[model samples]
Target chain A: MPQRMARVSWRLLLLGVLFCAAGLVLTARLAQLQIVSHGHYAVQAEDEHMGMEKVFPPRGAILDRNGYPLALTLDTYDIYINRKVWQDEKLAADGAEALSSVLGRRPDEILAALGPDTDGDALVAGSIGYDAGRKIIEMGVPGVKATATIVRFHPEGDLASALQGFVGRDQTGLSGLEADLQDQLGGSAGTLYFERDSMGNPIPFGYRQLTQSEPASDVRLTIDRYIQEATEQALDAAIEKNAANGGSIIVMEPKTGAILAMASRPSFKLSQLDLADETKMELYRNRAVTDLYEPGSVMKVVTMSTAVDLSLVTPNTTYEDTGMAYVGGYAIENWDFSANGTTTMTQLLQKSLNTGAVWVGQQIGPERFYDYAKRFGFGEPTGVGLGGEAAGTVRTSEDPEWYPSDLATNSFGQGISVTPLQMITAVAAIANGGELMRPYIVADVVGPDGSDETQPQVVRRVISESTARTLTAMMNDVVEGTPSHGARVQGYHVAGKTGTSFISVPGGYAPDRVITSFVGFAPVSDPRMIVLVKIDEPQGERLGGTVAAPVFAELAPKILSYLGVPPDAPALVQQGG
Target chain B: MSALDRLIARPLPRPFPRVTGVRPVLVGAFLVVACLGLLQVAQTSSATTTGYNLQRLQDERFATQAGVHQLEAEVAVLTSIDRIDREARGRLGMVPAGTALTLEVHKQPPEQQFVPLRFLSETKAPQVKTSSWWQRLLNLLPFF
Candidate 1:
């Protein structure tokens, strides 16, 4: 009996030891959960019970100068399909059929786009219309989901497409002013945190934190809706009439340097955007700011103005023209290749005499000519607040490839490249009493708090007011006297110059192609607007006065009349007449 | 006398007094716990209901915002220049003015003129025309 009792006691002692070990393990686990690993478990619990959501703000609208919406952001949806549901063939077919019906696509097409059966969701359609998306959601399709998204919509269609630019799939501005002023147009996104239930619904009385989103500022561009429409129509007509490759037209308020209308042809339609087509991407650029071409006789205006400002020559200053002027053994002749015996500075412009321009450049010399060119805002971007502005090339004497012929050619706007915006802004200085103004496209930015108006900014005084007036009179005479002057307004004194130059190729110049352009401002006394029209590779007529000046004539009269500037004295008869 | 003897002797006297089964402190603790449990249940029910209501309201707000966005898009399309031009040319039989006629009225220069808020007074200012209360009530009626 004593032995039996001893065995039982040993068992009890072993049981006690087992109980003690179990107790120690429990205590350690509890300590860890309550102390050492508390934060980890707590965070896991919070994650299960709490939720975070990113609150995206709406992108701003781009408006015209008259507060009409040019481009705006609108709510849309991205359709998604559950790949897990695709495992059930019937459900997948039903979902795809419903989506295809709403999206105007075949069910087989939709199914093919969804790919093989997978576990996660797949995007079926992006930027689906708002009404259709809402209808799909309300239909309660088993495997289909419509998630909210935003898309940029241009109300005016392709009116100023290149200037307004466009947004990508993520609603980010990709080009043009839309890309340039992204900061102001794209507002800051916010975050929201709240406690959620098992089904991911917010708990009514649960803790909530919110970081309020800042709304985007509405940008008002200086583009006048009517003017822009007219400019586009005119450009389209000119391109069709000339059977030309492409062209660009820019109309700016001379005094303020406000771009009223900017249009480029070979532009893609906004309603017909296809990102897959890489070739059309080139058409998406605003060529008025991006394309560089020799301004031809347009630069002669700059040269003549520079000479007049320096007192080196006047409109009456006489130069003997033998139909050819030789510099570095390179002969420069008039556009018609027939020069008058003794041509006045005014008559030089009337005839568009390249020989006469060369003579004037010789008088001013290379150093002062280039200096004045720089002063006139050439060889630099006009700072027009547009993306992809080219600071035109000017090969002055400082460069290695400089030649004496370059000086003569550059005088008449060859061997030099300039964007249409730069050329217009340069001539606008002559119209603005020689004060170069910084050109701007955006006129106002209206935010939630208030509106900010962009005040007119004067770059600098490049030439004297007297010289500007004298050049204006001379240009007016050129317009009135030239036989091919199609830029004349019925009852206005138009100051203008025509340009026609051969397009430069790899080695020399394109044999058959020519770029014709016209730069003009109307009502010579007040000079409210400046217009530049450039056409590339016309099939038949190629002279600026013939091809490009007529386009200016078409758009300018309408613009001036729209501005309510009463007509000045009636135009004078042609010199030939 | 001894304490045990006294107690035995005292209990036996008269009709024997019965002792209560429950202690006061235990009863008090039970009552307190029950009340607390009921209160917790009530608060949870209220909070859950509120959460559902808040969700519904948020959904409504989102729907309204979406509707506003839709209307804005529609208005933009309708007012777009392309649409206007098409409607004017095709539907309304209207053409753009071929000749712009200018009539220069003799008036004060822009700097010297007080234009007299013509646009505001003509278009925006609310007209304070005399109206009977009966007419106003009639105007509120859909048929009227």
Candidate 2:
């Protein structure tokens, strides 16, 4: 080629300039993405190849005092269906039918949950056992994935269902101790971050950020497995024998305010519970702590205690009982609608005489009466460390509905509502030397490292020790004086009172419906345990002595012996006495 | 001097000249490259091994945790008191013990009692001789 005078072509120059400018722009854009907005882009990249998952820590176990498990967490799988693939394949088998065989679900139900046209990870089944889940995983089913989740299981079935309670699908406590101590039982969740390789498997030793989860602590309740079973069995027998609708029983260590056992009928097992059923939902509330009723003449325990503590009456104190006493234009009549001339305080408690309770209330007067009621922890919650607790209703002089007749009725546990917990706790004060204790069921919070123990809390001293002794002695006379009343326990000087109050209807009171209850303690000398048995609407025998007292009489001996307490009476009752 | 001698005289082959800077430098470069290549290979192999080991360990940890939870749940179900009672009564045809005559055991006379040997000096150290678990631990001990 000849060296010719080179002419600079403007077109070539323009093209060169355009190329340089384009390269510069590309470099600048690369810098912006890789540097200026690096964190944002890095996050996006992580979202693509990296995965983030929630790691829920294991929930704590609820144990009985003897380290027996009440409620515990188990690992179960949530079976997810790759529905998109199923729909794409129009899966050869009816998926519902296929899964129904393995899952025990109705075909129609399964189909509704896993419809043929569904997309993405649809839940096919939940809470499948580990062995079953593994089998499913090994089946290599293309359209199925199994992920583990936690489920609550009660080892003892319905033994203490209402007390232990259940957890919901979201892994949160829903009721009972489960709800009350959620923070202690439910631990903090954590996140697991990792990058995946080409096969969609997490890359080992590659860019992983893990925040460890803390396991939830375990709860140790004061409830004894044996005592709880005994109470439930006794209550069940009582309900059947009395032909009662339902009932509640509370066994407490009066000395420590520890609820050894609390049981209620119409309870459902955690495993059998179906939240969708409204009828079963009512049984979820622990009636011992939640339900309120006219506690009947059990209020006499408080009434008589008030009078005895005030030195206004003794066991031998007498009151005149006219057939019907008129107060605030209301006639107060006994159950038999008759009079027992002049009644002694001991006879009043044993007979559950309404007339005598009114006279005692009259002697105490309104000011002292209301003050004693407040002192006995009536009209307020017992603070028993349960979820649904009720404060008993009382009409004091301060309330507008105060009636002179109300005082007469309230004396015998009418025109006032109370829970089984409150009644027992009040009577427990007398059993515990008149010191009101805040009742507690949970004994300790245990963990891998250590345990946090629940101390016995005394709310306050309600009455003098001497008063408690007098009342206990007087209560003992009630059981002994009236042996046919069924309050007497063999080989023990039992101290207790019986109560039967009418259930109020729209107007006055139901002729048939009545709440019959017995509140008492055993081995009256040491007073190891106080028991409350309340039966709702006993069929034939409407009186507390007939319906409720026998329950205590039967269960007390077994309970006392089980607790290793020597009897205060003859080793064996005198036969045919 | 003889003409033959002059023809045969090869000046004693100039002693081979001493090799200096250039050749040595070239050889050094080759050696450095080889060493670097070997180091890179070792690093890559170690990383791959570490990654595989991490994966295996992670799987093992998960499996163990799952196993522990499963066992806990199983124990709870089996040890349930109601089940035990039912099995005892229904399957075994058992009954609650009736009242019985009480008996008490008194301590033996001192002459009949055998006292535990008191060792002034231990002759042998207690060791796990048969257990494989202990043997495996022994394998980890440098002194063993």
Candidate 3:
């Protein structure tokens, strides 16, 4: 009896030991599932029921100041082929033939885009018209599908093409204002989350949440359509007539510093834009803001204006011209190399004499000359609200390359570089009573919230109002006194200065190549518009007064008549009659 | 009295009732839990229905926005300056206006009024105003 009882006790003890070991193993597994790998399991569970998708909003449209669309974002379609489904020879042929008919491409071309018969997706046709894409969809071709896409379109057919820039395949701005204001032009994407079934379709009754996308702001540039067209036509005509390499023209509202029109030659047309051609990359730059050239005699306006503002010289301040001024052992002569014996400050400008300009620079000296140049927004960018702007090179006495001759050359717009924008903005300061305003391209921005108009911002006063008026009068003498200058208007007292600067080469200046430019404003009493015309290397008539001034003379009258400014010199017109 | 006789007399005095199996507190707790479960199920059903409706509306809005964009593109094309210029010159036989001739109407100038120099400038024109350094520093304060 004792033995049997002991055997039962031993068996019960063994069973208790086995049960405890199994419980410990179960507890460890439970701990791992609940605590150690909890996050992993939780994410897996969420993946079974939840889904997220990104929603893209349309890009903004670029409009002119008067609400004319220049660049627009329009919905198109991208036709794609499923390579795995197209592996079937019959389905591939049928779909390719069907797509080719609508896409205006060969069947083999479509098939080639599809690639080898494998499991992948390929874009057969991108940015096809909406009507044609819809037709392909209606045909219900096998192994093919059309997805919606947004494309950047220039509706005006290359008008302001360089200014509008272009976009990449992913709908991102690549250049110009489009690249500068990407944040404002590109709308933010949104997110959507919902419960999904095993097949990745939204459940019939699922939890859904959406964050709506913010719409892009419409950018209204200060460009005027009529003025832009006229400027382009004028530049084209000038380039063709003079057989020049290229040119740039800019029209500005002096009072507000609003850019009315900006055009550059040798630019790509929107209809014929081919990004693969690398030779045309140089044409993509907006020369008005990016290219730097010795502004030639145009810098004399700044030099003379600085002297007049400081009471160092007056328009009638007289000086002796020996046909040449020796500075730093170099002889500087007038543009024509035949100096008048006695030249007044007014005559210095009327004749565009380099020797006279050197005399005035001597009065102002280099220290104050560069300071005033900086004040006039030279040696720096105008900050015209564009990308890829060149600040321009200014060699001062402090630089290693400086010589005393640089002061004289720079006095008449040489040995220093300035973008066309800087030249025009400086002249605009004189046109608008000496207040230097920050030039702006965007006039307003209309968004989903409200409209924001860009107010004119004044940088600072570069010169006194009295000095501006005095300089304006002197410039008027330069234009009206020299009727052969080709900048005179019949019934308008136009004030202008012409520049003829030689192109600098590797070691010295190019003997025959010159970049001629004219900067002018009309109705000098109360100037309305200021224009800058720069021609590069004209075949003949290389002087600014002859080549560039005539273009301005042709464009300015049309612009003034459009603005409805009353003629200040009706008597001059009557005399002509 | 004898013990046996006393016990029998006491038993006859009262017949106690048998104890019941259920408890009132437990039953009340179970009823409250069941009601909460039902409410949760109803709420989930309502939410799922609302989500379906929202999804449908979102799709419709997307389609309508796309249509509006299409129409806008069409209008932009039709009203483009290049198109108008071409049509005006080619179809309508129009020419650019000639050099403008102005007819002078001699009239007396308007009488000038004595106005303050400050008021003489255009109100909307940008004005340059200077502030003290202290004022500029104070503007940096959040509540200033």
Candidate 4:
């Protein structure tokens, strides 16, 4: 009995020792995990809890010459989703429906935009206005997030829509002056590293890291609102009166080459940009610098100016007009085929005689005349800092198929194309005493502060001062003397020319179709502004002198009055003379 | 004989094992080091989060300032007097009416007593024109 009792006691002792040993091993394992491997587990946990993202900085605004806002940024918002926070399919669907209703979109469309079964983080909506975003936040939908973004807005709506252009959804300039100065207008984006609470709300006194952000410099353009309005009104009136397709007008300071106003008819509204509307897109093209046209009789001024500059002819140099001039076996007739026995060079210009222009071209020859055209900024872009500028076509002397008829046709502004800007700028060169000032709309660039930096540049001198004076005087005769008599404004001496070119059709120049234009400067002695008015394919009165000249006359007086230019002479005397 | 028996009584004691293992001292040092490291990590994380928030607030303030300036510029442009005048006159062709052409001739003699009554009438009647329609109606109720 004693031996059996001792055996039971020994087995019990062994079981107790084994249990104690297991407890010691478990404690040792706990110490190793808590002390040695703690850092690895902690890092993994932090990665799951914390997140960081980069934030874009504020972009700058575009100002007019007078520090008025043309383009600016406004605070906007975007909607996002957290897949983990969304409790059920109903909650997700309801949130999307509420957003779509406020955004004026279909539920299915919003759903499609949110994408297919996103994991945790996904962008649901973009470019929502502040008020709409606020409303969505007020609703407090689970898993939905609202993020702030910057959006561009033009307050003036359609005013200068084509000139100032518009920005895209990504805040990049897409066209017009905006596209030309994109880098200067776009600021650097900054990074934002911040810790948030479990609810994704920024906690007070929370940890954050930020990089310094540089604001974009402001671009200041020289466009005047008043002059732009006047030009637009004048062009609109002319277009309506002529029943023409469309037209363009450009006004500039003759001496400075500062473009005061540039307008095109059928202008687009910045607020109503329809991407699918090709017709509206076509109107957005600035025809003043982009589209090239046969400048018609306006080209004769260049030819006449070249002749007088080279001393090939003087104001009194006489030519006998028998109604036609033959060049390369092709006969070019004067406008209306009016035959005059003998006419002075000045008289030929006053009448816009086609044959007379051809005679001057013949005297100057193709090479010299083409060089003069290039010097006057024809057949090239003006580098006006606007997108879609055209380098007009001027036939070269070295062309394989160069013909004398090409020169003759070009002399009267046919068989060659020039943009309205080129035509008007060349005229300004004559008015501004031969100095070919580089035309620019942007006057200066302003930094974040009020400080500004500007570099005024001039292109080159195209003609001698003496030649410019002679050309001005001869053009003055055209405005005041005979053909352009109707275009003379009261109490001001005007210098201008008229053009009525037959448009090119499938076969040849369309008989009934014409593009009439009038380009002129006011107070010829010291010109303040150069104005160009054009009308395309008028239903009636195809002559520039009859249609475009009256519009010029009406616009000039108002422009002069608005500019506060006192009358240089008595009204009746200036008008009658 | 009793004294000799008491003196002869004696006793023996059990022996004990020596505690010479290093486990207790090593565990104690590891626990102390882990507590100190945890405290340092918590402090660093808290400082980083606070610094990040401060910087983000500053950036937000700057952006708001830029926005305010931009809006002010826009307001100035939209309310410019020249732009308004051009739109009114050029687009609408509105001309101001001259007083010379619009003036009407009165064919009645002045109806009032001279001196004190004239002053009272002039002062009190001018208020009638500036009042609201309801006030004017209340004033005209006496005539009915």
Candidate 5:
């Protein structure tokens, strides 16, 4: 009996020890969860039970030189549908139909977006108006939701659209200056944290924390709103009247290299940008800096400037125009296929004589001509602070394709290509007193507290002040002295050249279509603005003098007045020697 | 009146004897419960005030933001070039002047102004629009 009692006692003791071991393990686990790793588990629990949200700051504003806002942000709401809440197919269809009526979207499309297979929420429509969003939310639909969002708005509509460009649905820049200055315009985002219930609804009087977002900075451009509007209106009228395919105009402050105005046709309003339309996408290109053309007789200024800068030729220097010049078996003739026997440099510019240009190029020699061209910024980018800027093509005598005849054709503005920006920037050197200024469109950046000013930069001096003045005087005669040569801006001493080039076909030049252009600067005594008007393929009158010159005559005076420049000309013509 | 008489005379007396320390234990338990109750009331009132303050601040912030947004939108529309031009032409009855600036390029060039070669633009004098040296330096900062 005593032995049986001992066995039972031993068994009882073993059971007590096992129970104690289990109790100790439980206590250790409790301590670990409640003390050792409390912070980690507590944070995890808070994250799981609390609701969080991402808040995106408003994108930056794009303003004109005068602080007029061109692009800005507006508060908007996006409608979404909760698929889980409206799991029933019929309920989902009914909800979609109600939303469709309010949002002006197809009910079938909304239904497909929130179909039974969907697992989460779906956006019904973006940028819904406040009234519309409120009405939809009030419909008492099972799954309807509305969240606040920010959208980009352009109040100026299509004015300078090609240059200002447009943003996407989420305020992402797609082209032009918007694309170039994306980082400065897109600000950093932040987040919000708060407690939530089992239904994922924000808990009333719940714990809340906020990490504030930084607002984007504002960009102020050198584009004067007044000038840009006037340019657009003038270019649009010229395009319609001439029945030309399209056109572009660039106005610049020669001294500052500040782009006062840039306008192109076929531009659309930012608010109405439709990316799906192919034609709209085609018009998205900024033609002033992107399109290339032969530039025709407008190039004569470069050839003449090259010769005059070398002191090899003067305005009175005589050149013989034999109607046709032979170089490497290639015949280079005047534009009308006829030429006067003897011509002065002034008369050659007035008439845009091709043979005269070739004679001047011959006087300067190929080496000097090519060097001057390079100095004038041909065959290089102007770095004008715009996207899609094209550097023109220029070939020297070293290339295998270089023929003796190219000197004649290139001097007369053919067998090479140039963008309007390049052409104007180079010519601006002559107008700006020999200094090649780096052209920029942005004037400064103004944030909330202070402003950052953009100082003008000089690339290099291309000629002496005397040479630029001399060239300016010779060009002046092209408008005022030439008989019926056109390109006259009344009340202004305008110096410019006209170009009419036949559109080059695959093998040779087109017989019918032509590109006409007029480039000039005004108030020869002071030189305020350099203007270039390029019209492509006008219907009736195709000469640069007839089609493009009048546009300059129309735009130059208005721009000068807007800039507050007083008229430098006397009412009566001065009697002179 | 002796001790034996007092013990027998006290009828329906304390079930827990004083010497057993039951009275102090009961009093201590009562005090702890009252203190806990008072602390809970104070905590609840503070949380309520905090919640109210948060809600009011959020509402005020939203209202201010809305006002700013409205004013910004109005400014954008009012400052638009197209709007200004239309107002000038329609409401103000303005007419355009001539199509050219008066300049004479025909005759012999005037005694050339002693035009000097300038490396940079001479149009805007640096002193005209800028502030003090410290202000200019501060303006250069991106987030000044």
Candidate 6:
């Protein structure tokens, strides 16, 4: 009986040992899962259930020199589709159709945009317009989603359109001042991450993460909005009055190289950019700095200035005009084809006598004349910070195409091409005491907190102070004298040159087709501002003095008064001069 | 044993006597823990409110900056030269007339010229005395 009892006890003990071994194994497994591999399992769970996404921050604003908003970023909604959320193909199609109806896009196009052939993670629907996007969001389509994006807005509409330029849908600057200062204007994007609920809505207090977005710095331009509007108005009027192709107007503070106003006609509104309008897109080209033209009699100013500066001729020096001059077997005639005998240098300029300019060019010689032209900022970019600037064509003396006829024609502003900005900036140099100031549109880059970095640059001194003063005096006589009496503005002394260049077509020079241009500074006694107005291919009167000069006369007084510059001279006296 | 039991035994309570001190101490400890938890919740909620307020204030600051910029741009456009010219030329019927006058003069005594200068003290001394009290009162009132 005792042996049997001991055996029973041993059997019990064995059962107990088995139970203990099972408990030890279970504890080891629990330790491995709960402690050793906790992080791994936690990460896997997060990946399957929770999602985090980064949101981009707002871009910067563009301001004028005095803190006027020229370009700005406004929050806009972008509609998108989640294909996975759609219950079926038909539901997705219905959602797309509904979105397309509001977006003004064809149903097929919207379907294609939302179709599942995308290489990206999400299928994209068409970007709806702001109004449409807002309305669609209100409709509350189940699978449709909306994201906020920053879009560039120009508040003044088309004012300074060509200079201020436009940005693409991607928020990148495409042209003009915007393109040049894009880096400074485009601020760094910020990131935001947060935990989302089951409905994919951001939780108010769940794992909130934010990186403060550095808003883009504001780009302050030298352009005065008021002056820009005036310039556009004047240019439009001139274009209409002449019935010309198009026109450009530039106004600059000669002393500082600050472009107060720069305008080009046939411009497009930034808000209405369409890909199909090729002609309108072409009009966005800043002709003042992009398109090259022969400056005509305006070139005479440079020649005369060079001669006078070199002491080759004085204002009182006489040159006998015999209707025309024979050079390189070609006859270069005056505008009227009639000459007054023994005209002084001053009278020659006032009358825009081609032969007189040729005589002056001869005195300057070819090498020195070309050198002076280069010094005046011709045949070079003004470095005005606008993209697609052309450094006008200057036929070099060493080129195989060089001819004596080229020199003779170039003397009177032909056989050479120059952009209007180049001509105006060069003239500005002459008006501003021969300092070739680097013309710039963007004056400074300001931060969101009003701190700023200004890039005010002065290129070089092109001519001596004395020479510049002398040239200003001569140009004063040209505009104030009898022949150009029409260009005289009341209450101001205008120093200007009129250019009537014939357009070279397939045949010789185009008949009745001319580019009439007037470039000058008002209150010439202390030239504060310089202006240039050009009219292309006027139908009726094509004379620079008749067509372009009067425009200058009309605009100068208005601009002067607007700038708060009191008349240097009395109104009636200025008109009489 | 019966006689000893009778001698040692007094009246005993019918139900088991309840322990008083230990129960109260445990209850008090539980209450203290509950109070601590409530305080923690309050502190966390206040911190969250402060954070929300800070965020709201930042948003307001940004909005104000945008408004100021917008108004400044409007002012610039309104005060632009072109608009002024339109008003002056179209509405005022003004044209630029260039007539200048030069006053030619012979040399005169340096001190004999009439100078347009006014002594502020002499001009407004009585007025200043009359308004001094009111000015001081207004200065003392910050809102005014």
Q: Whose TM-score is greatest here?
A: 1
Better of 1 and 5 by TM-score: 1
Ranking by DockQ: 3, 1, 5, 2, 6, 4
Ranking by TM-score: 1, 3, 2, 5, 4, 6
lDDT of 1 by residue, A41-85 (tens): 999999999988766678888999989998887777898887777
How far out, in Å, is residue A342 in model 2? 1.8
Sort candidate 6 into its docking category. Answer: incorrect
For residue A369, model 4's alpha carbon misses the true position, in angstroms, by 1.0
Candidate 1 vs candidate 6, DockQ winner: 1
Which residue ranges in model 2 land beyond 4 Å of their true spot? Answer: A1-50, A90-113, A131-143, A196-207, A571-577, B1-48, B97-144
Off by over 4 Å in 5: A1-53, A87-120, A129-142, A193-209, A398-404, A572-577, B1-52, B85-144
> What's the fnat for candidate 5, on a 0 to 1 scale?
0.35
Give per-residue CA lDDT, model 1, range B25-69, as digits (tens).
679888889989889899888887887798679767766776787
Interface alpha-carbon RMSD, every candidate: 8.5, 8.1, 4.8, 12.2, 6.5, 7.5
| lDDT by residue for model 2 (A1-577), tens | 2223233456667778999899999999999999999999998887889977677788899999899888888777888876566664346246556666678878677556766556567787899976677667666565667776888878887778888888888788898889998888988778888887643435657777779888789999999888998899998999998899999999999989999999997677777889999878888989988888998888887888898889999888988878677778888888778888888888888777888888888888888888878877888998877887988788898898787888888888899888888888889999999998888998998876698998998988888898899889888888887857687876778889888888898988998898889999988999899999999999999888889999998888778888877666545523231
User: Candidate 3 overall Cα lDDT vs. reference?
Assistant: 0.87
Candidate 3, residues A36-108, lDDT tens digits: the string is 9999999998888798766557899899988988888877788888787888888888888888878998989
Error of 5 at B94 (Å): 4.6
Clash list (residue pairs), candidate 3: none
A118, model 1: CA deviation in Å? 2.3
3 versus 6: better lDDT goes to:
3
In order, the Cα lDDT scores of the candidates are 0.88, 0.83, 0.87, 0.79, 0.83, 0.77
- Residue pairs in steric clash, candidate 4? A206-B49, A206-B50, A207-B48, A207-B49, A207-B50, A208-B49, A208-B52, A208-B53, A209-B52
Top DockQ model: 3
Q: Where does model 1 exceed 4 Å of error?
A: A1-53, A93-113, A129-140, A192-210, A570-577, B1-40, B103-144
Query: A251-271, model 4: which lDDT tens digit per residue?
Result: 888888888889886667788
CAPRI category for model 3: incorrect
Candidate 3 regions exceeding 4 Å error are A1-53, A90-109, A129-146, A193-209, A571-577, B1-53, B107-144
